[model samples]
Every structure is written in structure tokens, then in C-alpha cells.
Target: MGVSPDTAQGLLDELFLISRALRRNLAQPEEGRLLPGGISVLVNLESAGPCRQVDLAAQIGISASAMSRHITELVADGYVLRNTDPDDGRAIRVEVSSTGHELLGRIRESRIQGLQEVMADWTQDDAERARHILHTLRSQLIARDSRNAAADHQKHSEERIDVQ
Candidate 1:
């Protein structure tokens, strides 16, 4: 059965509220320490190990130039280290520094504490279910977005050919 209009509206409203709450209430890594999107870069590098700038950009779905800007700021902040790829001297690989790892650990602890405080009233099962549902929703959204982007690109390419 399809969701009713009212149910859909409610879902949208709740999702917006959740987004705002997380953005505003979640403990920030540090005040004026890292540029916007820097945390994502650091975390990804830590998880994925040293990676070329282009690869990191593609993985994060950002332009290489934009990613480079973030990397520059991160490097200046001593959170990331950049070095020439030994296998490909033309490419630069980025890795998280020791300081970056410590910062990430602190951020993780803060977020965990914040989440625990927020979910204090929830049962263990409720917390587990919430995590599962959120992950499933995120995966579905990403897949749908990727499919839409591909279709749009194909449509644009066809339109260009048609015009020619």
C-alpha cells in the first residue's frame, strides 16, 4: 500500500527535524580548527589509507579542485600529510597524520557521548534498531541518487547528440 499524503508529510517533517538536530546539537570536532568538509577527508583517509587526490575526490563525490582546497587546509592544519606517490610520481597521495587520528578519536568519543545522552531514555533494542534503520535509509538514498545522476547524464548526452 502507498503511504498516505499526511504520512509522507510527517515523514519529511521528521527527517528535516532530525537533520537539523544532528547538525546543531552534535558535538563539533573543534571550534575554528578545521575547514568545512575537512573532517570527512581526514576520516576517509584514516579508514582508506593513503589515496591519490583524484581518487579521494571521486570517492567523496567532489571536484578534484575542491578536494584539493580542502586538502591544502588540512595539510596546513597538520591533520593531513601529502607525499608524491612512489609508484606514480605525478600523483600526490594523502594520509591522515597522528594529530588527525587523535582529533578523530576525540570527535568519536564526543559524538558517542552526545548520542548516548540523547538516547538515554531508549532501550538497547530501540537504539540498535534506530542505527539499523538509519543505515538502511542512507544506503537506499545513495543508490537512488546515483541512479538519478546517471540517468540525467545520459539524457544530457543524448540531448547534445540530438542538437548536433
Candidate 2:
């Protein structure tokens, strides 16, 4: 069964608020801390291993130029290493450096500590339940977005064929 309109609206509102709050929190600068975008790039690279710049941009939903800038800064900061793509001599692949991994560990620890403080009133079970529900919701949303993007691409391809 579909969710009620009111429930859907509530969920959207909550998500929006959560996103805003997180953005605001991340905006507060800590000494030697990476910006949110840079952190996201590092995290993605760390999890996905080495990837081409364009592929990383697409995966992170950012422009290639923006990804290049992030990579440049990261490389300068010694947080990532850029190497020639073995399979494609002309292309470059980026991977998290040892320093990057160390930074990520620190970042994770800080975030966990912050979350622990925020959730201090909640029981362990409450945190686990919330995590499970949020993870499922995130997976469903990604799958739905992938399906929609595929359908749109197919429609555009058919339209181009009809025109030709």
C-alpha cells in the first residue's frame, strides 16, 4: 500500500530539516578539518578504491571540473594519490593515500563521538533501530533514482532515433 500524503509530506519535511541541520553543523570549521565536499570525496575514494576522475565525479553527483578541483586540493594536501590508469594510459585514477586513511579514521571517530553525545538519551536499541530504518530508506531511494534515470535515458534515446 502507498503511504498517505500527509505521511509522505512529513517524511520530506523531516529529511529536509535533517539535511539542513547536518550542513549547518558541518559548516562550523575545525582546525585542519576538511570541508564537507572534500570529506565526501575522500570517503567515496576510500570506499570505492581507485577510480577515474570523471567516474568519481559521476558517482559523487558532482561536476567533473569540481571533482578536478577537489582532487587537486587533495593531492596537494597529501590526502590522495593520482596515478596513471593502468588500463587507460591517457586517463588518471585517484586513490586514498595512507594520510587520507588516517584522516578518515579521525573523522569517523569525531563523528561517532558527536553522535554519541547527541544520542546519549537514547537506548542502544533505539540507535540500532534508527540506523537500520535509515539504511533501508537510503537503499530504496538509490534504487528508485537509478530506475528513473534509466527510464529517462531510454526515453531520450528513443526520441533521438525518432527524430533521425
Candidate 3:
């Protein structure tokens, strides 16, 4: 039989708790130079190279205004560089600077240290399985998002036709 609604909700709650714990442990302090939100943007840029601001915002799952504010903070902190998108002059693109890359490395190290501490009692196999499970979950989520986006686009197109 398919999973029950209660079982699915329980799994979602567990995932949310895991996300909260990671953010609590790894997020930068308010008094610190970097905000956790900005750091996340920097990390994404560091790995993804330059990306259009709107596209980056969508990928990060934040509203455009929120991403703009995070990008402004990151720019002020010298952790990222903003430039005109060569392909689309009206659009802005962002990339992590050298300083940002260094900061990202430190952030990654800190996260690894935190995970190590939390998983100290777990065996190597447990850690490996957890990593694999997370990867699978991420892939599934991405696929679901793609499907939703396509459906939304189709609905909007039909609405426009009806309007006409």
C-alpha cells in the first residue's frame, strides 16, 4: 500500500527538524560579519560560477527581494561581485570573489566539524547511508519541483488563452 498521510507528515517533520538542527549549528551569528542567508548565496555562487540574479534567487528558493537584499549584503562584505549579464544587458549576474571562496571554505570546514561532533557515536556505515539518503531526497525534491513548475506554466498559459 502507498504511504499514509500521517506517515508522510511524520517524515516531513523529521526532515524539517534535521534542517533546523543544521541551520542552528552552522548559521553565522548575528554579530558576525556574515549573515547565514548571504553566506548561503556566496556558497552557491562559489560552486556555480556566475548566475543571473533572478535565476540564483529561484535556485535558492527565496523571493527575489530577499535574494536582492542578501546579494547587497554579500556585495558590501566583499564576498561577491555583481556584474551585468553579458548575454542580457538588462540583467545582473553574480559570482563569488576570492574572499568569498575563502570564507566558503571555512564555512564548509565548520559545518563538517559540526557534523562530525553530532555523528561521533554513529558508525561509518551509518554516516554513509545518511549521506546517500539525503542525496536521494534532494534528487526527488528537484524532480518534483520541475514537474510542479511545468504544470504551473501550463495552467498560466491556459488562463491567458481563456482571458483572450
The candidates, ranked best first by lDDT, are 1, 2, 3
Model 2 accuracy (lDDT, Cα): 0.86
Q: Which digits, one per residue and each the tens of the lDDT, describe model 3 over residues 13-129?
A: 999998888888865453166655676777777777899878888888899998888889988888889989899898888998888888777777888888899889999999999
User: Which residue runs of candidate 3 sit more than 4 Å off their true CA positions?
Assistant: 28-36, 88-90
lDDT of 2 by residue, 28-123 (tens): 343136544898899899988999989989888899999999899899889999999999899899999999898888777776777787788999
* Superposed model 2: Cα runs more than 4 Å off: 23-36
- lDDT of model number 3: 0.84
Alpha-carbon local distance difference test for all models: 0.86, 0.86, 0.84
Tell me which residue pairs clash in candidate 1: none
In model 1, which runs have C-alpha deviations exceeding 4 angstroms? 4-6, 29-31, 149-164
Each prediction's Cα RMSD? Answer: 2.6, 2.3, 2.2
Worst 10 residues of 3 by lDDT: 27-36
Model 1: how far residue 23 lies from native, Å: 2.9
What are the TM-scores, per candidate, against the unseen true structure? Answer: 0.82, 0.87, 0.87
In angstroms, the error of model 2 at 67 is: 1.2
